[model samples]
Target: MITSISTQIQLAARPVGWPRPNDFATVQIELGELAPGQIRVVNEFISVDPYMRGRMSAAKSYSAPFGLGETMTGGAIGRVVESASDAFPVGSVVLHQFGWRDVVQEDAAGFKVVPEIPGAPLSLYLGILGMTGLTGYVGLTAVANMVPGDTVFISGAAGAVGTAAGQIARLLGAGRVIGSAGTDEKVALLTEKYGYDAAFNYKSGPVREQLAAAAPEGIDVFFDNVGGEHLEAALDVFNPGGRAALCGAIAGYNSTERKVGPDNMVNMITRGLSLKGFTLGSYLDLAPEFNEHMTAWFTAGKIAYDETVVDGIGNAVDALLSMMQGANTGKMVVRTAVMADVIR
Candidate 1:
């Protein structure tokens, strides 16, 4: 009989503005022997995303709020150590929604086995090879209808999805790619490493002026991650018949007060621009197509990504908070002790 203990983080209380450490409670629970058709997994890496901030709040949204006192759930990839099911044998790598926990034992149906990609860390499954990459790909192709030779601009370009969006935009044949980051260092990284034609630090000056200076001829496509000022800037600089994919509004995620809408409301009507807001759930039908294209590009050495890894499940809350504050340059993930010696 295999008995184990799992360290899990739970939502203790709904956050008001920004989440505090007190809002999350880390606890340990012992597990009994696995039942028939059940599997036990030790997590390697867990994802911490900006969208999760919304889930912490009690307000109604696209995804249901995380129940108080329950384990925080998101994306997690791990290896099965023991299993009673034939489908998930011992040592199979799997991905599941049982997140923020170092160990999990659940029915086999809740987990999906995935093959290990040679030379790439399994953590990539939590980032570029997973939802983060798919979001960027779908936003550009399906939602924004980005065509070749379009001048593309991505806000919050140093973050995980933003970095992926910038690189994917270039590969999609955009004539020019511009990005905005919080700091000058991130801005430099965007143009130098991510193939962004131009990049600007949004904190340096007014977003409208900086964006205009970057795209003097005007932009045809906007992949917006930061709303408020960034959205306003994109609208002001968009060419006639331009398009936008409203991916996120992290700027207002922690606000205690209501955020004002963009002042440039008439630009949409006068410029004949098209804007669409989307959640990944509505566009998951495109996953097969995204995997094909992304796999080919990544395997061919065309894709470049960065990850900011924090060492332990206990610090998951800190990692999430830092990421939301733009302290991370790329994907922010929490690594567990079980991750050791797994990836070559």
Candidate 2:
């Protein structure tokens, strides 16, 4: 029988810098009777992303800040177990944005029905087939305007969007692909698993020197996931007419002090480089194009990806912190319950 309560992780307090356990509170709420056009869903998988950190801050950003004492929201995929809406039937698989909870009751409009593929897991909706993959495709194709034969460099190349960016760059016909990771293992995975032509551990040496050695001829495109030093290095090696997609700056997300930017501002003018920072919210119009290409690529076995899964809703906060600390290989997802049990 379906439970009559919902468990949620709420924001208890905003972090000063790095988030702490006391910053969140786990609470349970009594489930109310479903209203017309509403559905009850049991989340199967929840996504933990770096972007959420920015939302935790009270300062304004592209998205609004999460209200303290309220349930934190993010991407989640669930199975509708009870429904009062004709559009969403019981047993329907759906994806929604009401997350940080194990079960949710919301208007059906909050949910979107997802196709049930025979072999693929629903978790794909939160990763490669989802927004993360779209972010990568958008960065390379639209933001950077990459063309065939361009040499591309990606920072934070082992994480979700980074891994996707590396594969998407190659798929988009980049002549050479290079990546920067925090660890040697991650660097190795970039070259071996993600098909990066060359990869370096930023911790091993200065990024500019390592990148210069990797691509002696210089890069035509850069996908900046880790800003600060990575951005500085990218600026140093960009060829004339190079383009860059400034995706995120995980390096400074939790800093209590002001983070210094790259020192090479003159490179932009001298190299005639174009750099643009983008948020995925502005590019939903490209969803059809992203889905069409990524689906075909995944179906054809041309793209490679990974996920670091943390089990249980109770561990969601830890999963988020682990991901921010670079413990995750690709997408960091939380599996709420046994997949078969939830579906059956």
Global Cα lDDT for candidate 2: 0.92
Local accuracy by lDDT, each model: 0.92, 0.92
Return the TM-score for candidate 1, rounded to 2 decimals.
Answer: 0.97
Clash totals for all candidate models: 0, 0
Worst 10 residues of 2 by lDDT: 335-344
Q: What would the per-residue lDDT of candidate 2 be over residues 75-172, giving only the tens digit for each residue?
A: 99998888999999998999999989989999999999986544677888898789999999999999999999999999999999999999999998
* Model 1 segments more than 4 A misplaced: 1-3, 341-344
Total clashes in model 1, counting residue pairs 3 or more apart in sequence or in different chains:
0
- For model 2 the local lDDT of residue 63 reads 94
